[model samples]
Target: MTVLGEPRTADERRTPDRRGAVDGGAWRARARRWWPAAWGAVLGAVLFAVAHRAMPDDALISLSFARNLAEHGQWALTTGIEVHTATSPLNIWLLAALHLLTGGHAFLAAGALLAITLAATALWLRDLGGDRVALLGTALLASSPLLGSAVGLETYLAVAVLVGLVRYAADGRWLPAGVLLGAAVLTRPDLLAAALVALLVLLPGAPRLWRALPVGLAVALPWHLFAWWRFGSAWPHTVPIKGNGRGWFDGSFYLWNSWPDFFLVSFTGVTVVALATAAGGLAGAAWSLWTRRWVPVALAAGAVVHFAALGLSHAPPMMYYAGPPIGALAVALVLAADTVRWGWIVPAGLVAAGVAVSVLHGPGWADGLAPVRQNWATNPEYEAIARDLPTDGVVYSSTEIGALAFYCQDRGCTVVDGVLADPGRVDQRWVAPWRAERPWTALNYRHYRPPAPIPARWRLEMGPAEPRPGDWPITRAPGVHQVARLVPEG
Candidate 1:
């Protein structure tokens, strides 16, 4: 070794330099390889950030069920009653399990779910077409205004399931693919169509893929069968209770209305994704027809079939439902690109546009305290109402009962609603499905049981909230909630 002041030989100098160069090269290589996954991490972080911050009134409905299940070991939303209003069984179960795990913090459980599903989605996309596919797909999803607003719903879980379905189908892993398909249906029964279309178009060459059929039935049928036996109807009570949506199944509507979420609630992102879907779908279909490249075709068809299913069912054009297909189309566009290097440019540009708009808009993503714009009232307002409600007897709410019921659960107060908190009533009716008759609903008399006639002690009244965004005349200003002590009717 030379003294500190002495200059080292050229060999010694080159040795450290060479090692530095080699390490630098390796690190650079790793960065290059994982750059795409970096975007996925960004997506997950963004999702987790917003998920628990605020959610729509509908989301709290699910959480209420989870809370009831977790805390009381019962399926009823309130004591002395059982309701079947929560739409997704899997969402309820997942949320309930997480709810207990998190020591009864409801929103934290939702945030946890959002992160978990984002990771699952990223992994599945990476499996399908390396990290770039994950990057492109998650970016498309993250940029959407709809999915961000639907953080606490089954949308995130459903998306992760669908992405996994696509991956398994691409791999010819039909058994697992079928299981995912079943889970997809349980996430929202409407997703079954998308699941079938993805598998059929993606792998028509595999005859053994038929094995998926029986396995999927085994997984999904049990839940439906149990709901029928236990709840008196296989269909969600929500089927009839919620809005059936607009008559928008036409070609013209499909072209413009399928995906309408704007970036940062601006008009910029409104039709951007819709147009991309049309152009990308046509291109993907054409490519599949000409070159037998069915991957693009499968993606396009899955998106199309999902929207079609939603349209035919007159399902509300909820962004949560629209988001998964938007993601599928975005991925298809990238994969169907004429040149791998540039195919991502256009879709990536749209993503950039979304992020840019949000950045320009400012202050929105910085806080997670605002619920979705579609909410009936702010979280604090709901909490205040729950806090002020009477500690006992029945309380009725005509507006925004989900959060009210959830917050009021531990108050020794029984919240009942014609809309939710209680499973109101199913009239005497019968309908035939094809050639078979099915049990329409379970008639529960919880509200009328012995010591039964629980008179409404208070009525939580509120204005119609501007008659819903695009509906007819606006009768009253928004945010009108109050409690009135009710008198028993003779």
Candidate 2:
């Protein structure tokens, strides 16, 4: 017979706020103090999801292929499923590992890895800077749209390794830092610059350089050895495989145009305020460098070198590669906002608002999931084409053709060429179709010059060639057949 209106006491009463929890006025104070860091982390998660959601079909398909290869043991190395190009295997490995851990859910595994990377990145930033600076840096990184697009990609993997190296260096942990850089080298040879940076930053004061170097070398040796064994070269990861030299100036078009658009898309949908804050921080950092301030100078120098290395590449680096610089920019902004005219808090509300908007928008971003989101069963055409084929069947296709091979491999389907499997194979295949049209070389395309004869052993298949009136003679060639036509399953 308890009274209906009476408030409960002791055991029935709401537990007193925990010792760590803030109450009433104290809650407001804590909120004011911690809001920036919390908002930054939230914003980062949103932008990260957006980029991951919008990944192109080709890239997602490659990742799916890599996962399938590892699950089925088609390839020894975690190399991507396509004719293997020179991209680092770490990104694929990450995806594969996630798939393995999660019982083969490709999209879930990738999404998990992407989330983990974002979280690790924020934690790494916090370790590099203090909590406040880390929060600000993470806010700048997570809210920017580019982060989502690049997460789980090679560029993001490189950046994550680089961030790990920087954190280890900052903590005076030379061996761990070196090991991270070594992994960076395995993943992307261009990260040699970061390795150099780590050495410069970590070695001078290390008490036992010999001991630390070996520790790092030991961890990285297996991958190095494996690369040598597989590719017949120590630096099998470079771009020269495509006849493109090691000169850094080859890929300017990608760096300038594609990267910015990537960033704009990744950022606009999430923490828009972070962009302004990052810009302000970049400007401030530049000013600090001009004034010869040591801390800002160090960060800016590292960032400039990083940006320059990426800029020199023939392929434009992904937006996540910009994380470290963005983090550094966060440190700069925090410093400027707090110490420089007390203007640091200006963007804080905008960051929070942006985060709120992203969260409120919920899961609609799933609409953007493309080839990455669907598994083999969803793509019946590839499976139908590959059905009952030999595991080692010499089929020619793009880097993502592994998606088909994943299912066909059980039937002994052997893919002779894929974009990511072996660069040499892909290059050879590119010339094969042209050569197939000739008499001795009878290229498969039949569109080549000199009226080359078709190959006797090879079958000619045309995939939905658009109407071109002048090409009727070539289209009407004997033995020509339409093998398959793919329409969006959606």
Against the true structure, whose lDDT is highest? Answer: 1
lDDT of 2 by residue, 1-490 (tens): 0111121344432233332254556576455444544554455455555655545433444465556565765442222332334356666777777888888877667667655665665565544444554565556455444344344455445545656665565445667766776676666666666455544543444444335456666766786566545543344423433223222235443443543454355444432543564576667666654643323334444555665676655443334445445544554554444434545464365356545554555553443432112111223334455563433224444224434534554455544333344445434543344244434523222332221221122111225466343221111112332233222111
User: Clashing pairs in model 1?
Assistant: none
Residues 1-490 of candidate 1 have per-residue lDDT tens digits of 1211122356743453466557787666556444545566667677666544456667888888888888887776665577666678888899999999999998888877776777677766655555566677677667655566676788777777877776666656779988988898788877788778877876664555677777888889998777777766676666554333333334233322544433224334534544564576567556655766666677778778887766665555444557667666766765555334567777677677656544543444343233224444545556666776776567876556776777787666667766555554312111112113323222422222212234566666554433333222211213434223333323
- Clash totals in order: 0, 41
Query: For each candidate, what is the lDDT?
Result: 0.62, 0.47
Give candidate 2's root-mean-square deviation (CA, Å).
13.3
Q: Model 2, which residues run further than 4 Å from truth?
A: 1-52, 57-62, 74-86, 198-215, 241-281, 287-299, 316-365, 369-418, 422-424, 427-490
| Prediction RMSDs, each to the true structure | 10.7, 13.3
How much is the lDDT of residue 72 in candidate 2? 64
For each candidate in turn, the TM-score is: 0.76, 0.60
* Model 1 stretches astray by more than 4 angstroms: 1-42, 242-289, 360-372, 425-455, 464-490
Least well predicted 10-residue stretch by lDDT in candidate 2: 451-460
Candidate 1 local lDDT, residue 298: 73
